[model samples]
Target: MTTATPQTATIGHLLRDTDLSRPAYEQLLADATLLKHQRASGTIVPRLLGLNIAVIFEKPSTRTRSAFEVALHDEGAGCTYMDSASSHLGSSESFEDTAKVLSRFYDGIAYRGFGQNSVNELANHASIPVWNALTNEWHPTQALADMLTMMETTTKPLQDVIVCFLGDGHDNVANSLMTSAAILGMDVRIAAPAPLQPDPAVVAAAQDIAAQSGARVTVTTDVDEAIARADFLYTDVWVSMGESEESWDHRVPLLTPYRVDAAMMSRTGNPKTQFLHCLPSIHDSTTALGKKIFNRYGLNGAEVSNEVFHSTASRVYDQAENRMHTIKAVMLSSLASMTQGDR
Candidate 1:
């Protein structure tokens, strides 16, 4: 991994996974792993010593929000968090104006929101690095954490690994997984009902990346076919945030068959196959949504089962933990070289 010098201080924002080349992706992973170990050993380095960053989230999050806040604090930086209710991004003032104003106060920005265009507009306005924490289109930061978890759990090289995503294949998590896996040279499979499969353009884009990286990218409706000997079984919420609750009426029946239950895991034909969910999962009737799902559909889970989510094969929690490490790497690589005078 080549280190960035002061001359190359302003690394571009991570608006999407394709923003990173193969070498850059690998470098970030290596940096993340080192940072994780350093954090564990109490030798964590603080790169953003005097920097101040802001996280503006238009969507609600548990992992991403906590990860960004903790990661910045660990790196000796000050951070301010603005939730959707607190920040009037488009309603009160334009996203462009908000971006320009915030850029002056913060060194970098992390935004999780509904439209890709919002993040794009913000990035266009700000001179500093802007990361897309989430959008309707992509979740690159989550994908980074997920891949780091995969590397920790598997012995095979990335090129030889197979990962299958089940349910809501069109969602942000699926898109990012396809994009990141292709860049990392992993065999990627998407299994969902026909209506919920990933966008053709997204598949085509991942395929183009795969062609250069020797990765295989496939989308299938047959759950058994997609999961065959898969090294990882991944999922996201069948319906995402900002989507109407009414969407569940249609999505539930269509996605139930693809749910990551023990049976679906067994279909993988790999007993060692680990389960991954970009959670807030409907694993049990613990949350209000989970309870409603069970009561309405007579289904205990939406995209994953309780048995699997809490099982030994689940690495979802580890995946969540890695988000901090990888995000720290992104910020450090992007802003660490800039000094007070440079700013």
Candidate 2:
């Protein structure tokens, strides 16, 4: 892990995982690890002390929002949050206008929303650095946190680790994970039904990256093949935000077979194999969605079983906490010119 310096800052916007070069990606991971220790030791030196950032969420969030807000505050910066209902981003004002306006007031913008183009359009217009919090196409920040978590939890170097992601292979998290893994030279696998598999373009792009980085990328319908010998097994909700509840009517039957349970964990054939999820998971009949899933499907969990999610092998929480650290590193790296103290 290399230390991140101001000179390492290159990209002005992180709209996708490929936005980061391998060195830049590793640098952020190293900085994130350093920041985590700094926070724990109460030795954090505020870098972006006078910076103000605007965080806008067209989609609902808990972890992503909290991570950005806390990361800003922890670094002695100010942030203004605008939720879906509160923001005039897409209604009264155009994205270009909104971006131009925010650039005048804020040092950067963080957007979590429906379209990849929306965030890209915003970044195209804004002079300040922009981050894609999450979009329909890619969740770059989540991938960064995921990678950092893998690095921390495993003894093997990331390039040597095998990661298998199951369920909704075409989704944002899957796309980002595949791309990130390719960039980092990791063995990445995705398992899903034929119709639910990743987009061909995304797969091709990942393969191109893999060719350059020495990564092995595999996409298949066989869950057993994907999970075997994997160091980490990851999944996300079958249905994503902004999608209608009617999605469950079709998705349930298609994704049930891919559900991660004790049996799937055992199939990994490695006692040291760990579980990962970018939750809001239906591990129990607690939340409204979980209850609906349990009642209709007669299954306790939709994507991951409760036993595995609560098991010692689950590193989801560690992955969740890394969101803040990695996001902080992103902001620090991108907006290094604005920081006042030592990075």
Candidate 3:
């Protein structure tokens, strides 16, 4: 495993998948793995004691929120969480003002919200490191967790792994996944309808990175071409957060063919092939969105079938749990230079 040298001074923030060099990414994963072990064995050490962080979310989250709060607490750091309803982040107070105010009270700020520009503006004004938990353009933290999960689940080297992401190629998850995979020299394929495919600029950028890293990047409408011989079959929600319910009407018809069912998994022709999803997956008609999808589309699930989601091949839970460990590593790495005296 490639270990990362502590480069706290250089790692000011995690705003995008490409923010860190490949070695930096590997180090975070290495640290995350060690942290996981330490936590499981009850040998945990607090690294960010006396530090404080502010997490602001314009959008709701489950894994990202829980992960950050728990990771900070485990490291003996204080965390204050505020959603749009609670804080006048963008409504009353400007991002610049909020950033300045939070910088005085916290060692770092993590924002999960709608726009990339919003986070960028906050980072511009804030003296402390600013992490982008998620934005309209990228979900860097989720991508990091996904990378860690892939590293843990596979026997192959990071560069040798083949990941095929199905459905909603234009979304933030796909963008981050493609960028991260390219950084690690992984073979990444995106299968989606023409309209839903990743932005041409993102694809071109990933291709450019892939060329330098010896990675094979493929964007195709052909599911067979993307999934064939893939080690991991990945997917996300058909409809993302903050999307109108009307999105289902159009997305259902377009994404239905790309859903990760047993049939799609078998297409990989590798029994060891695994399934990955950044939940809250609609694998069953349990949630309101799931019920709505079922009632309207006459389908039990969207993006992924229940059978595949529950199968042993499903590593979603491991992926979900990894969010915490990876997040801990990121927080520690970025704040590595900080000391109790500084705090």
Query: Each model's TM-score, in the order given?
Result: 0.96, 0.97, 0.96
Worst ten in a row by lDDT for model 2: 1-10
Each candidate: what lDDT? 0.89, 0.92, 0.90
- Give the TM-score ranking, best first: 2, 3, 1
lDDT score at residue 190, model 2, on the 0-100 scale: 99
Residue 214 displacement (Å), model 2: 0.5
Q: How many backbone collisions does model 2 have?
A: 0
Candidate 3, 18-81: lDDT as tens digits: 8978888887888888889888977887888789999998999999999999999989999999
Q: Which ten residues in a row have the lowest lDDT in candidate 1?
A: 1-10
Superposition error at 238 for model 1 (Å): 1.1
Q: Per-residue alpha-carbon lDDT of model 1 for 1-343, expressed as tens digits? A: 2332222223578999999888888878888888888889788657777899989998889999999999989888999999868988888999999999998899899999888999999999998899999999999999999999999999998889999998999999999999999999999999989999999999999999999999999999998889999999999998888889999999988988888899888878898999998888888888998899989999887788899999999999999999998888888777754743465
How many angstroms is residue 250 displaced in model 1 relative to the true structure, after the best TM-score fit? 0.4
**Across residues 146-252, which tens digit of lDDT does each residue of candidate 2 receive?**
99999999999999999999999999999999999999999999999999999999999999999999999999999989999999999999999888999999998
State which candidate has the highest lDDT: 2
Q: lDDT at 251 for candidate 2?
A: 94
